[model samples]
Target: MLPEAKPGPARRLVDAIRYGNSVVLTLLAMLCALLVGAIMIVIADPPTRSAMGYFFSSPWDTFTRGWHAISAGYVALFEGSVFNPDSLYSNGHTPIFGPISNTLLNAAPLILGGLAVGVAFRAGLFNIGVQGQLIMGAICAGYVGFAFRLPPLLHLLAALLAGVIGGAVWGGIAGWLKARTGAHEVISTIMMNYLALGLLNYLLGISGFQAPGSNQAISRSVHGTARLPHLLGPNLSLHLGIVIALLAALGCWWLLTRSTLGFSLRAVGANPSAARTAGMKIERSYVVVMLISGGLAGLVGCSQILGTNHALTGDIDAGFGFDAITVALLGQASPRGTIFAGLLFGAFRAGGVVMVANTGIPADVVLVIEAVIVLFLAAPALIRAIFRLRESRGGGVGVGQLAKGWNA
Candidate 1:
């Protein structure tokens, strides 16, 4: 028998490249965003522009000064979001885990919000009203947290359940409209957001929800019994919400990959007409998927109110809903990917403040980075063309696929 031929170094290199293609593309996109941000920084700074005037005459000086400014900004971002080695010895009172804790706290809601969008994407639904759903959830959860008197653990559970139910009902309305009246979810969801904002404004004026002796639009604080316990200590902001977010991510993964209903949802998303021909209940799937998606979104409110904020305010939603759409796309609509994407975005959010305070870089720069990332992700073909990369074995999903799913 002839000996089996071993794979050569070139063949192994090709396989590795193919296997990590998506990750490589994503990293490259991030690099492009950073480069753009650096250019913006230079343009915004008068000193940097003056130094660049002598690019050819004094190349070393120009390069060193420009690089120094860019590095300082990124270093501040890193220290604020991840860790600052200087903090270890510079301040005896500084908590070693403080920065990481804040990052986790910020990421918790993003994970839940991203899952909401991801779940809807899997079912051919566009749940743009996640903002409204989140608001409703916070209202319901906040009411339960302050009004009800119960055992500690049970009270917390009750408040969370109330939030979930509120979000489900809100989402179900859009699904029902889509199924019965042929209303597009996008339009219905947008309308619902306006309605929710109006309702929130009205409700805040009521004595029942408003804080005692306060003219502000904030609701009463949640009771201690209903509050999510801190995983770290009172000094740190990190709470049990991170644990819940991780569990929810795992649940979403199981639902999408293992459950029969998930299969039905995917089939409908791929082709509603074919799904209907196969005897699958497309309309019901829409309602079910939206309900679940909204419930997931509602958890963002829980994280904010019960875990972090502990009070309901007009701005409680914190843009998590819209940011989630980008997170979902960056994650490619996968639960695991959503978690990583959420963390990355969370880091940017946490770091932006430090970058601004220490390096004088505007916080809006982070927003620009996020927008650029979305631009690149939305056009994978452009990235491939620029990089001159060969197509991977499974190829890639694009905005076209997402659009087709919506139509289906």
Candidate 2:
């Protein structure tokens, strides 16, 4: 054979750009969503209407007015989510770290839940029942937290263990059904969610789960010993939950990259028939992967119960499970990417509140923006068409591919 030609400098540059195209597209999608949100704000604001009317007549005044509104809104978003310089002097007791602390607090559960879904995605499983698993975890952990009083360290550890086990069992059921009966996880998990909700409602009515002298559907607060210690003192909401989430993310990275089990899971996800032909136990892999995924999701419940809420209520889930799917999708189902995506979504949750308070814009607008980003991410062809960009060498994973791999 003749000597092989190596890639030229221009080709290498193209390869480099293609390698990072996913991240670039993600950023561009966010920019487009924000721009659309700004337009909506302008259209919704009555003051902006008058400014628009005078655009041709008083261009300077119109431009200034529009700039002020958009700038103020985004500024409030940054101040609420990241830092507020004004809070340093105004709020004597509250430190400047308050906003960031809140962001981390919100991000903790999101990271855990995203990891849960991401791990399952890597195993060719759709774990849509994280909400149910989360509820099961809360039930077990809450019971351990309040029913028995052990030493400080042991009590917390026991509650955490109980949460993990509960979620594992809950998720294992779906895996078992998928393996044994050929049941679709999507249908089963959705049904499980309703079952979990109903079970939660029933348990809340019982004397043991119901708080004393209260008719509400709330469990008793956990003992002080079982609660997660605050990492940033009592002044801030930041807790050990964030640390746990980070550690879990690290563990997931190691598991998916370095472990034999991870290799099997990936093999099965890529091609189940080939994996099975190679002597991999596809059914067992499903069970084990789901068990681990459920455990991660359970940690989200523990974070809420032990780290923040300290008690279980009817609405304890707060839609974190559903939000996690979006986080995992945005992160491309990678551990590090999931962590960053969780933080970004957490920032939106924190800042959106301030955006509403400061600018009279509805908080629901943030949801719209998130939907737009997801839409753009889902439809890469649309993005490429709009931006006239070349296709990347490595394209992103899509929901259709995920679904197809389920039976593969």
- Candidate 2: global Cα-lDDT? 0.85
Cα RMSD (Å) between model 1 and the true structure? 2.5
- For each candidate in the order shown, give its overall lDDT on alpha carbons: 0.86, 0.85
Taking the tens digit of each residue's C-alpha lDDT, what string does model 2 give over 1-408?
999899999988676555436777788789889998887776767777797886888788766777777788888888889999887688566478888888899899999999998888888898998899888888889889999989999999999999999888888888888888889888888898888889888988889878888888888889999999998889999999999999999999999889998889888887889999999999998889889988888888899899889888988888888998888888878899899989999898888888889888778778888888888887766776677777655554445665533222
Clashes of each: 0, 0
Q: Tell me the TM-score of each prediction against the true structure.
A: 0.94, 0.92
Best by lDDT: 1
TM-score of 2: 0.92
Worst 10 contiguous positions by lDDT, candidate 2: 399-408
**CA deviation > 4 Å runs, candidate 1:** 1-13, 16-20, 53-60, 404-408
Clash pairs detected, candidate 2:
none
Error of 2 at 265 (Å): 0.7
